[model samples]
Target: MSGVVVDVRGLAPVQRFINRLANPDLRALADSLGAELESQTRRRIAEEKTAPDGSPWAPWSAVHAATRHAGHSLLQGDGDLLDSVTYQVSGTQIRWGSPLVYAGVMREGASQGQFGTTRRGGPIPWGDIPGREFLGLSAENEDDLVGITEDWLQELMP
Candidate 1:
């Protein structure tokens, strides 16, 4: 079954950051920003116009295209606030499952010139570099998802 496997608890740092920035207005700003970003990303992703069978032109072609395009838009908005927040809060790599639904984050540095994978039980670039961001991967299972999310949250703790 498809659903949000990674619990959003790891997003506390992001929430904290936003809270600091907006202060008493934090909740309003965050709600507006989240809604805006989600709406925009969804609209951009919808432009693909997939076939009746729900197949793409090629493997990962649509996902990559949509992600790159949406990523660019997100980056260009508000001093890359969404991009930075996404990288810091979530991770830098995003992934798609089946017809739609994407996860992950884009890290700051490219190790060996590679963007890390979001796969569960896979090796990530954690603790390998300083000041680098990571993306969360949609785990293959719920347990794995929880583990990854918890790991990310711990990384943000002081």
Candidate 2:
């Protein structure tokens, strides 16, 4: 699925250098950032909306809902998307994503496109699916992430 990226370019040169240092303790900073993003994204996914704007995600497509023997509202309703969410930290990089196949589709939404055929043997044209920025940060969430990272970094200073 979609993920979040936090830019650490604004950190003071000294701190930024520390981030790139080849030390185990310094790596904790990246891990802390990753943990924060992972937690927030999970929260947003559980809420089923973009964190920044609160935009609602499109319900499951009719075909998918029908095949799953689930009500329209039940598609992606079991919290699989939320459960699949995870994060990783490698040096200065922090990444988060979901293993769900439809995760990207739900996050980015689909455009109107023709499938092979409809039930009536006519071409199936999917409608535009609105994107839900669940992995994206709201203005306030952004502030919190930054604040949390800065605080973590501050603790690293002598």
Instruction: Judging by TM-score against the true structure, name the best candidate.
Output: 2
Give lDDT tens digits, candidate 2, residues 1-158.
89998786776776855764535375677777778787888877655555357666666566655667442242247777877888887878888878787777667666665345677765444455556666767777778878977887667664
Give the clash total for candidate 2: 1
Best by lDDT: 2
Q: List residue ranges in candidate 2 displaced over 4 A.
A: 1-24, 58-75, 112-128
In candidate 1, which residue ranges exceed 4 Å CA deviation?
1-23, 48-158
Compute the lDDT of residue 90 as modeled in candidate 1.
22
Report the lDDT tens digits of candidate 1 across residue range 122-145: 445432322111222212223444
Q: How close to the true structure is residue 158 of candidate 1, measured as C-alpha lDDT?
A: 43
TM for candidate 1 is: 0.21
